[model samples]
Target: MNPGSLLAYRHVISNAGPSDAAPVLVTDTFPSGVIFDSAVGADCTGGGARCTIDRLAPGDVITFTVYGRTDTTVRGTFVTTATVASPAENLYPDNNTATAITTVRIFVYLPLTLRSYRP
Candidate 1:
């Protein structure tokens, strides 16, 4: 993504269990390069860091779309993290968190002048 451009992040949460998971909570932490704009989802609210799901049955899936704008002066790469939690007992804690790394590409424009001479 380029500087000052809009960026969207999609997070897919799935329940791969023999039981239903209730009261699931999803949280995200945007890096310095991203200025959080908004979020779109069933239980998502205003702002940029958290989402909630009342319940998720077996083989059920939910998703959240998070939007943000790239900082004009930001360069290089930035990292963002998202995590999910539930009241139900979790066997694999390692799969509860996800990380994304994004690289920013910048373009510079310079003024050009043309000169003419009489022959």
Candidate 2:
């Protein structure tokens, strides 16, 4: 990704339990050099980084997309993490958290200086 460019992230959550899971809370924080833009799916708030799901039935899957813009002056590797939780205990806890990393690069060009000499 380049500086000042848009960066998008997608997150998918599924309910694997046989029974319905309670309301789920999904949260993500903008990484350094990133500014929140927009989000799709779920009731997103907190600068489009937080979402809440009323309920998730068994075998139900939900997807979310978050958009952000890179700071024009910032360049480096930015790591963003998202986590999901439910009021009820999750049968599988190992997959509750996920992360995405993005690297921003910028290139610069300089013109050569020339001088004229007279004899």
Candidate 3:
């Protein structure tokens, strides 16, 4: 992504349960180099860091699309982490956290240099 460009991230949350899961909440903390732009499939809060899902049925998956504006003043790889949680107990808690990585490219304009003139 370039500076001041829009970067999009998709997060998939699944309910691999034998029973229906309760309301799920996805919280994503965007890196410092990105500002929260907008989101879909879920309601955003905490400056687009937290998203809420009404509920999830068994074996159902919900995907949330998050948008962010790349900060023009920053560059390099920025990491955004999203964590999902529900009131119901999860057997496998290891996959609760996910990360999205973004690398910002800054174009550098250089002036023409005259090293040697052989005219």
* Alpha-carbon runs more than 4 Å astray in model 3: 46-48, 110-119
lDDT scores for all predictions? 0.82, 0.82, 0.83
The superposed Cα distance between candidate 2 and the true structure at residue 13, in angstroms, equals 0.7
TM-score of each: 0.83, 0.82, 0.84
Model 1 residue pairs with clashes: none
Off by over 4 Å in 1: 45-48, 116-119
Candidate 2 local lDDT, residue 35: 73
Candidate 2 Cα misplacement greater than 4 A, ranges? 109-119
* Candidates 1 and 3 compared by TM-score, better number: 3
Better of 2 and 3 by TM-score: 3
Query: What is the model-wide C-alpha lDDT for candidate 2?
Result: 0.82
- Order the candidate numbers by lDDT, best to worst: 3, 1, 2
